[model samples]
Target: MDHSIRLQIEEREAASLAPYATLSRETKGRFRPEEECPIRGAFQRDRDRIIHCKSFRRLKHKTQVFLAPTGDHYRTRLTHVLEVSQIARTISVALRLNGHLTEAIALGHDLGHTPFGHAGEAVLDELYPQGFRHYDQSLRVVNILEKKGEGLNLTVEVLDGIAKHSKGRREILPEDLSELPATMEGRVVRIADIIAYVNHDLDDAVRAGILSESQIPSHLQKLFGPTHSGRIGAMVHDLVVQTLKNGGEILAMTPNLLEGIAELRSFLYENVYETNRVHDDFIKAKKVLRELYEYFINKDDHWEKVIDYDETTPREQMVCDFIAGMTDRYALDLYTNIFLPKPWSVM
Candidate 1:
């Protein structure tokens, strides 16, 4: 069989996709260019690379919300990324944008997230001199940590989308366009990230018995809908309608939908994320990471155990990298090994 499938797909993209879509053929290309695959376009290739990388696989054991949740149904980082990819692709397809690029961005967006979710992030941000943000760490994962530091070598478009997907406690569609990802596909992932997390987090909170459905603000329930799927559907529909109405030049949501989402986020911050029960665990998780950070930095023997440690890299940065890459179970087990007394056994 002829192996010119990539070329054929590129031709189809140009013939069918929107004017503003980020086509695979038009990628800014990887930092270190290699021979193109015969069967995959650049963005599709990027998506595959991200999916197969070690860092992406670690996402399954990482926290999304509820710290080390015992419940089978709570969202892990992997599930959250999948949800974001699904929603982003739906929007991209509606807008006639490149779904592959959108899925690539979504899949790679949270590759750098820490164990115990944002709690671990807060601890790293305070301890590290330069401060830590998961988005930057995620970029570092692809650029320097994965594949024995050879890196994923993904396209610039994917990297840009991954780097800029984060919007911490800010408006979904900010007044500053510069803060957003460069491509329309990237913007789709950005919105989809928040949409996925907000609804899923709320659902998890209710499932965990932390918040009753009645506790959710009546106005938001009315504005979006009463159920999780209802809320997500409303937001996704609004986003597609507004973006299409604006001719796909910019990704957008209706003013009311944006306001509702912002309010819902604030409610979660106060009631779910920052409440006493959650905050207590967050504090304990911070201590675990902080002690691990100190132990690894001060003890060369401990540092040597790190799989990717390099003598040339700063000890502090190496510690941060190791800690950030850890899964929730790994972090907890390591903590127990380092700090907790083992059973007295003499064989």
Candidate 2:
């Protein structure tokens, strides 16, 4: 009811959080400074902003692993972000870190991902001059694309976490911490991203009949767990226990646990992602995005109609933004509308 609730929350955080936890009150602040909210702390405000933004909403139709999966239970990008948020918050709460910041970062981390998952991403990278990384596009979304070029103006901490969240094929906890987010809460989200995807993607793969439970190496099954829930629980528990044991100095996984996850990831790549079962869809998705990219880039009138802001932005960058913002259905529809022949109608 009171406007000063933010201060009360800040006080509670200062008293309860670990020394390493990022304090919302002391955020590096937004790119464009403004008056503090009456009731919301900075990170809380950021979380709310991301939840309400357009890009966040578009995540529902974006691909996590499968392209246009007919199965209702498959994990879409939105579900993936929610799961990442849930897992990251759990770890943050367990470690006495900043949960709100972690959630904000987790939710916003994939806002820039292209439709049709990494296949669309690969096509964009190949076509664009400077190349496209969804992490950077996500930062661009929050900083320049959302709010019609006004941007989200989120705090530097949120921006940093979103920017650095991608681990690609790299190790979960690299020796080089410099490239990781500066805050421990941010780092928590980074590791949580990996945990969420590896487990869930495998689950989706199994559900799609792409892989069977027995196909997962027995050693890995033993190391992580026999079930999806069991593996996630094991990974989350290990991360929280390790971080707390180290006094929140570093967000970590036991070397054995890390190796188990890494091995599982390799298995997914070799068996599911690279196999023709997935690649057929991936190849089609790539062609769809590639054709769309070329059409928008070469057709000036169509490009002008699609992009409505800032004439000075590079054509390639604008094309990337347009494509990256599209959902799986939207991309398919646009491609069909532009390329497919419609039935003739008599007046």
Candidate 1 per-residue lDDT over residues 137-255, each given as its tens digit: 99999998888878889999999999999999977898789999899999889999999999999999999999999999898999999999999999999999988898889877878
lDDT of 2 by residue, 1-347 (tens): 46678888899999999888899888989878898998889999899999999999999999998998778999999999999999999999998889999999999999999999999999999999998999999998998888887888899999999999998899789879997999888898898998998999999999999999999999999998799999999999998888778777887778899898898889989998999989999999999999998998888574433336666778888888999999999999999999999999999
Off by over 4 Å in 1: 1-3, 302-310
Predicted candidate 1, C-alpha RMSD:
1.5
Q: Candidate 2, TM-score vs. the true structure?
A: 0.97
Which residue segments of model 2 deviate by more than 4 Å?
302-307
Against the reference, the lDDT scores of all candidates come to: 0.91, 0.91
Q: How much lDDT does candidate 1 score?
A: 0.91
Q: Count backbone overlaps in model 1.
A: 0
